[model samples]
Target: MKPIDPRLLRYARATRLFLTAVVALGAVGAGLLVAQAMLIAEVVVGAFQHSMAAAELRTPLLLLVAVACGRALVGWLTELAAH
Candidate 1:
């Protein structure tokens, strides 16, 4: 019936901090996912539709890699925080 259980707040103070970390990591992970999708779309459209050269697609491709790595890191961090 309660949004947040009062017992948790009273008995598990560390949980508040842990929950905050999890929420922040979740947001970061979601943003990274969106960035990854957008970058992939950009690269695909540039290469296939626009017939762009490799040089033109380089930046987006590199950014896509970075975003992928970031997502991995976020996942690792979430796991660490959960445990």
Candidate 2:
């Protein structure tokens, strides 16, 4: 086949970047899900074993959720920026 144009190569680059961002989003979502589960488990376990009070659990759980949301927002921003 003949050589492709530079513009075509740029399309390929954008497509690759889009795909990379998609994969990163998936990986980040999965990772956040796992981490959230682990953190909740840790909180419960610590509360039971170490006798942590109610207020102590609330802040950490809220923080974990906030961080997960932040990760999601980052993924979205990355995709938008790539475009």
Candidate 3:
């Protein structure tokens, strides 16, 4: 048995670009998750400490939803790229 060369590995898989995309998306998703967590913490702390109303929190909630949807879209695109 022989070891494959790193450069040739890209040719070995039809989904090489797809795999690359998945990795890139995974990185983006990680950042989004961190942002989401921070947004959640801010909302919670603000609500508790400043007595912020739900209406005031609406924008942050929407931003969170957008981040989640962006992550989902990335996953979907990766899946599409695979085939």
Candidate 4:
């Protein structure tokens, strides 16, 4: 195998770390997205199928909002890292 240059190694390592962070953040965002989707589905299904009251869904609705915000924040952080 060819020997790697010291400067090249530093740059490669930095790139790898940045990519790793971005991927981790992206995975977090994906998980948050899934949570948000599930929450929305539950709310919709509950309302339509079970005729659930808004008061009864307050917790899940709040959680849904929180997850949506979390997903947005993660997306913003990922964009910042990419730049």
Q: Please provide TM-scores, in order, for all candidate models, with all chains considered together.
A: 0.85, 0.55, 0.73, 0.85
Count backbone clashes in candidate 3: 0
Model 3 residue 27 CA deviation in Å: 0.7
Which pairs of residues have clashing backbones in candidate 4?
none
Angstrom error of the Cα, residue 66, model 2: value is 1.4
Candidate 1 error regions (>4 Å): 1-11
Q: Once model 2 is optimally superposed onto the true structure by TM-score, how far is the C-alpha of residue 52 displaced, in angstroms? A: 2.3
List candidate 2 segments past 4 Å from native.
Answer: 1-13, 48-50, 71-83
- lDDT tens digits, residue span 19-67, model 4: 8889999999989988998999999998889999999899889999899
Compose the digit string of candidate 3's lDDT tens values, residues 1-83.
Answer: 98988878766676666778878877887898898898888889878998999899898888888988987887787677665
- lDDT over C-alpha atoms for residue 62 of model 3: 89
Which pairs of residues clash in candidate 3, taking residues 3 or more apart in a chain or in different chains? none
Cα lDDT for residue 77, model 4? 92
Q: Give the worst 10-residue stretch by lDDT in candidate 1.
A: 9-18
Quantify all predictions' global Cα lDDT against the true fold. 0.93, 0.79, 0.82, 0.90
lDDT of 2 at 83: 63
lDDT of 1 by residue, 4-83 (tens): 98878786887777778889999999999999999999999999999999999999999999999999999999988877
